[model samples]
Target: MLTYEEIMLLITALASVFSVIAVYYAIIEKNLVRAVVFSAIQSTIYAFIYYMFMAPDIVLVYIPVAVGLYPAVILILISKTEKVEKQ
Candidate 1:
């Protein structure tokens, strides 16, 4: 079995990679819906990293706020906005 530190390191690395990908996707994606999805993915990875650090309480609180509420709010805002022409 992997050591705790090793597992934490791996989770942190994965979180970093996910964050970078999310930023890149947000910049490149013209569609608001796609950007919101990418942001949600990044939030989920961050919650995983928090869990790996033995912060279950933080994960519990953050998952709903970040993964659930944030995405829902973004979707609502996006739905209200007028569609823009594709560049």
Candidate 2:
């Protein structure tokens, strides 16, 4: 069985990798709404990684701004514009 530290490390690694994939998808997505969702997923993964690292303060602030507020604002802005990229 893996030890506690080993498990935590593995989780962090997996989260980090997934976050990278999320970021890539967010950038390449032509649909604005889908891009926003991917961006939110990346932010949520980051928040979880922060929590795993035991940084409560950073996680608290990041969760509100990155995962919540930023995505909501972007989605609202997307609603005001074209849903898909022209190119």
Candidate 3:
């Protein structure tokens, strides 16, 4: 059976992988909306990783900053940008 630490480590690894993938997609995606969504996904993974590390306070702080405010800000920014032209 896996220990708590081992399980947390595994979860953290998975979250890290997700974060990397999200960042890659965000950078490569042409659509502003898709990039914003990817960035939000990355933030969520980061928050999960922080929770796995047993930093609940960090999770608490990160949740609002990452999952809440950041996405709203990104949405606002994307709304301000001109429409994307499809290739």
- Candidate 3 positional error at 65, Å: 1.2
Q: Candidate 2 on 1-87: residue-level lDDT in tens?
A: 999999999999999999999999999999999999999999999999999999999998999999889989998898998899998
lDDT of all predictions: 0.85, 0.95, 0.86
Off by over 4 Å in 1: 1-4, 85-87
Model 3, runs deviating above 4 Å: 85-87
Instruction: Write the candidate numbers in order of decreasing lDDT.
Output: 2, 3, 1
Instruction: Write the residue-wise lDDT of candidate 3 on 1-87 in tens digits.
Output: 999888878878988988999999988888878888899899888888887777999999999998899889878877888545366
**lDDT of each residue in 1-87, candidate 1, tens digit only:** 999888779879978887888879966888878888898988888888888778999999999999999999978987898444278
Q: Compared to the true structure, candidate 3 yields what TM-score?
A: 0.86
The collision pairs in model 2 are: none
Query: Could you tell me every candidate's TM-score relative to the true structure?
Result: 0.81, 0.93, 0.86
After best superposition, candidate 1 residue 80: deviation in angstroms? 1.0
Comparing candidate 1 with candidate 3, which one achieves the higher lDDT? 3
* Clash list (residue pairs), candidate 1: none
Provide the lDDT at 49 for model 2. 95
